[model samples]
Target: MKTEKPISEGIMDSLQMKTSFKDFNSLKNEADTLYLKFQRMGFIESELLELKKENDSSYLADFSLGKKFSFLKVFYSSEDFTKKELQQISSEVDETYFILSFESIPLSLKKLTAIRNQKGNAFARVKLTDFEKDENENLSATLFIDNGNVRTVDSIVVKGYEKFPRSFLKYYAGVRKGKIFNQKKLVAQNENLNGLGFVSAVKPPEALFRKDSTTVYFYLEKQNNNLFDGILGFANDEETQKLTFNGYLNLELNNNLNYGEQLLINYKADGKEQVNFRTKLTLPYLFSTPFGLSGELKIFKRDSTFITTEQQIRATYQIDPRSTVYVGYKGYESSNLLDEAIAGTPIDDFKSQFFIAGGSYIKPQNRKLFPVKNAILLDVGIGSRKKDGKSEGQLGVETTLNNIFNLNYRNSIFIQNQTSVLFSESYLVNELFRFGGINSIRGFNENSIDASLFSLINTEYRYQFNDGIYVHSIIDLGYFENETISIKQNLYSFGFGLGLNTKAGLFKFNVANGNAQDSDFSFSNTKIHISISSKF
Candidate 1:
């Protein structure tokens, strides 16, 4: 007849396998295996003490204390333990061990060190050790949730602010109570809040269980107003034909207002002086209810070389919860960069000024085609242009489908098309930048095109570095047909190189190869650009 025994009795019996001989060597061997397993799971030598075997001819043992956390002991003893009995013993041991707790533990450490796996005597720890501590000893927490599922929180309890509502806290929550939650999704929404440049740090919700059901809570820290920033740099440019010194001032005013604003002004000089000024006022909560409003004005002057001014007003209203519908108006006038490139005949002779007013509906999607993170965008714009005896309106569509579907990597495909009037042009083909420098056909020259309905299919693959720098490889393909130059020269180019896009604007340096038709006519096209924009 078989007799039922307590779990401890079973464990103690297993330890007594060499009891008849009291084999210290066999006992030490088993202890050694257990020690190695613990060590692999991050328990160091200092955390272990003495391990001893019982003197009797029985399976029994004990370990001295020094473990990082408290533990419970279960003994297993069996004269002839079967496979099924060992499996049962393991299940019982695990179920018993997980309930043990240590007192006076930091919450961060507690949350990250949960046991993830146990194979016999071996185990695995799930989270990284460094994740538990912040620079100031503040606890770091992470909460993961499935995409597209809503969670309800009864009330938000904040500790730092005296003039905000629980709902206002929801804005800072970077998540909504009834909205679906996904880790990447929440981060994107919170990033918008961060872009407002008000909060110093924002953290996501922590999943907790009360009575066997799961819930989430968020924690955040806000920075005070009056922020100051500066930048200084030296650059040499082949396009500008000058080596220049650059500096700027970035100021944030009344950051804690519904209508937040920033001021940016910069100066640059090589053999001459240039000044650029830009400012924007944003209404984060325009009339409340997830609607936004912003206004921007910019001016640039460079002492008889060039001068330009632009004004814009944009507003976006959230639609379908996960996306927005936006409409904006912008007007700008600027001198042509190729004023001297047009056979040295000042290309700026064509005065250009236009007002663009258009509406677009955008949807945010997760998971992309290919492993790269991308966005899928569909934009349609209608506007009027009054320049060079061409007073006409334009209709256009721009697509960034990669950004919608791929949300975790750096690669994109962009297709932009514009349909116009006041001239008879191809409905589907007007302007196209097939290849060259950075955005499109990469093996060719920069802005090396004539005219038409141009369609550019450009792809860029970018690699990011640790010290705020990145490099990219680009491909550009473009074609244009001028009535004067009847023979259409379709250009293709491939380029690869690096660029520095810091707090400073783009200063790209690349080497490219281009082909106009079957001829291999290419040149080194480099660009040195700068902007003291307070925002990325």
Candidate 2:
């Protein structure tokens, strides 16, 4: 297999020569086959210069392998891009071939035909002609482009769900009329659409290319993304020494009118004293425009002590298929109902107004479940706070991230973190951030903790016996600081749970024990939670 001047390494290994031949003619034929293989591999000047019979069963093969030839020059024309753009691509190809020892001609030819492919030429071909080889083996050839036909998108037809939103075709699927036909992007159309959670792919998208226009077809069915969820908790009160019942309910509606709109209603009655309610509405792609509008309202009461209300309105724009940016105004008002000031600080009425900005990115996860979504959200506010008739500047920030790593078909690990902070000279009791329970740290009473700043990390390791049955272990850690009382503490909790997916809903149950600030775990302090979430 060794020749006079080898083109490069690994070329001999690439030749599929017969190790044992029946006769001398068979050996010659094998050697001849290698020449054609080398020629196809960019050694265009490879030839069998000589063959010598060493003995009855031994032979020496000699060959003249030419310098590896790549595209020293390529000439072509395209209707989509200008001549200068084409020259820039050609110049890039020229730089790719330095000494021309590697066979990369096909890859360069792929680059040559890429523009036409993106410009409605799916079957474009590059034919090299008038090849001229110099003494140094540098070859220059003309590349004649054979662009089959122009295919401009005429329309996108939704088959299964005929009433599916048409605007999503252009904004989400990247398909529209007069747009150039691209097979690669079209092949990925189902993935792009599924990311929005509006619909599931019945099959891959299809294309009907004709001389006049190209028609893109989408086979999809609407998904039941609208959800109703509830969580129930039972625990023993350390002070009261009695069993307590608490829980939360959530209702969300999405794409009801097929315009990608969403409405959420959530309410929580965690304890006898703590009550929370919230509502939000979002309208996307408003009036055939790229902008969206959203409004949110929330109210919280701490049993005859203090009540707080917040309202926000925002405008959103899609930065891409997976991301969105929003800017809005947030307003908060709080009043003392019963509780008095502590630590010599007066608990008075307070109000705040902030201009808020935020962005969100959602990444779909790989999981064998009804819903497989992961997301990240960041929101920050710069505003003014008014307390005791004095106004001061304040900053507020919130961040959340959720990620899932699938180990295999049956196991996974999930991690999520949430942090919220209100930065100011002082904070009122009613205005402080509150968090607890299933949505946050487990094995704790809902809304049982308050702080000016807090961050929580939730980790879960799950094992699935099947798509509908699974078990998981939960470990949560958190830290919070309350500046009003000059207190800071760390929190930790551990728990185990199992889940069952049914036609009515997906149910999960957990038993956990939580401890904070060096407190020892107690069996009486254990909390049990049961949750049911359904999408329809």
Candidate 3:
């Protein structure tokens, strides 16, 4: 017989052939599946193939595929892309895809395969090497794709916020190093920074990718917080039947000496020879905690009406961005100087000490000017008045709403109602609520109506033009009741005005008509109101 090939050698050859075929088939099947998937996705010119030698243990695959142009075509021209369009597309694509590796092609492909197997077809990677335009000027890119791992944040860098502590910024970022970078969280942090009132502008966080890590950078622009402002205007006092010149001056130092502290000195004078002065200091953070401290001293003196002075110290704790609770101690002293005719009775001086507690909820609009959107304030206090040696309690609530329509036309609606009640053995002129004037029942004299219980509502509709100027119409209703004094009155007023807002303050001119009874309405009793007040 012819020398037969050894049986063992034949068996070895058969096993090698089977293993090689299996490896080649595995790679070919995977490539073919990807190719067909891309073709169905409208990548008409795509191909995938494997090369393997009969005796080699490894195989090499070369893939040539067309990049999906549908998304690009929707936003860009086929020949080229505008800068903004390109940036938008790049951002969208980066958010959608994660690149696992840019070096070592085999490892990348292997990792991609594992990811694809685990994630079912939701993952993809496209590496473009060249671009070619077809007869229709449609662009196509050579692509190599595989599943990839998402990039994690390596570090965060903050720039252009020199006044703010780095720790503060990091705390607001609300992220740790080496965590998966999230675009939504970054956007939230940016918005939070903008709302702090210290920053004028904030750029979107930028991600710099390196290998598998992403470095995020935050850019900020700070606003000027140190200012000195003044306001000048005129007012009419119906009680005195005299016209008065009114003016205010304010000095502010904010975020300079302390991180976010503010110091304010304000002085106001009116033509009635009345003067009011106040000094206040605010510390936004107390000992690095979320609590705040504020101290104020106020002095008010009118020639023949009253002389009042108050010292207050308060501590506030922030519950969140929109809420706060505060407690304070107030020492007040007042001397009533009204004549018997004006007061309707003889009144004595009073001294009081009080403990006050309150809370506020403010929903701020996201705008540079006129930031208040909605707010509520409630305060309750219990005290002892030394003049009468009696216990006294007071409650006050105020609410405001603005921008009701949420329209870009700059239309706004505002409503404010305040009620103050006192519990005491006997009512004193200083303790009674006074209603009238521009701040209360417009078209009436300041402090013209005084009673033990008083309530008032002010409603306004405002329309803004250009250059921070606005026109507004207002309605005011007020009621006063005093069973002990047997005095009851209802007052109503309607007015229209124009105002100009400046960085320093707001200046307004108003004309109003008031009537104590429904039948007493006439333009002959019109009142003129003028005022200017500092913003800070």
Query: Tens digits of per-residue lDDT for model 3 on 1-536?
Result: 01122224642343232223465567566556655554544444656644444445655545465444442222222222234433432433232232222123234344434433333222345345464566886754443445355566688787787556443354333445765666655666666666656564467878777765678888877776665666768777879878776877778777775377788897777666577689999886566566789999988776677878889999998776667889999888998777654645535688878888888877656554456667777776777777766555544333332234345657777777767666666666655655678777688876566677777788778787855788889798877776456777787889898888775566788999988855567888799987655543
Which run of 10 residues does model 3 get worst, by summed lDDT?
72-81
Q: How large an RMSD does model 3 have?
A: 16.5
- TM per prediction: 0.46, 0.76, 0.60
- Candidate 1 per-residue lDDT, tens place, 51-130, comes to 43343544443443232323222222232232343343233323222121222123323332221111111122322232
User: Residue-wise lDDT of candidate 2 within 1-536, one digit each (tens)?
Assistant: 56765344465566756778888888888889888877767777889887887778888778788676644554444443465545544444332221222355566567767767877787888756776776776676666778888777788888998878876776666676787888777767566777666687788888887767788888989998888997768888888888866778899999988888899999887667787899999888877766889999999987768889999999998776677899999999988885555564446688999999999987654343624467899999999989878999999999999887878878888899999999998777787888888889998888789889999999999899998999999899999998878889999999899899999878889888888978987887789988888989
Count of clashing pairs, candidate 1: 66
Each candidate: what lDDT? Answer: 0.42, 0.79, 0.63
lDDT of 2 at 522: 89
lDDT of 2: 0.79
Give the candidate number with the greatest lDDT: 2
Leading candidate by TM-score: 2
What TM-score does structure 1 among the candidates reach? Answer: 0.46
Native-to-model Cα distance after best TM-score fit, residue 91 in candidate 1, in Å:
28
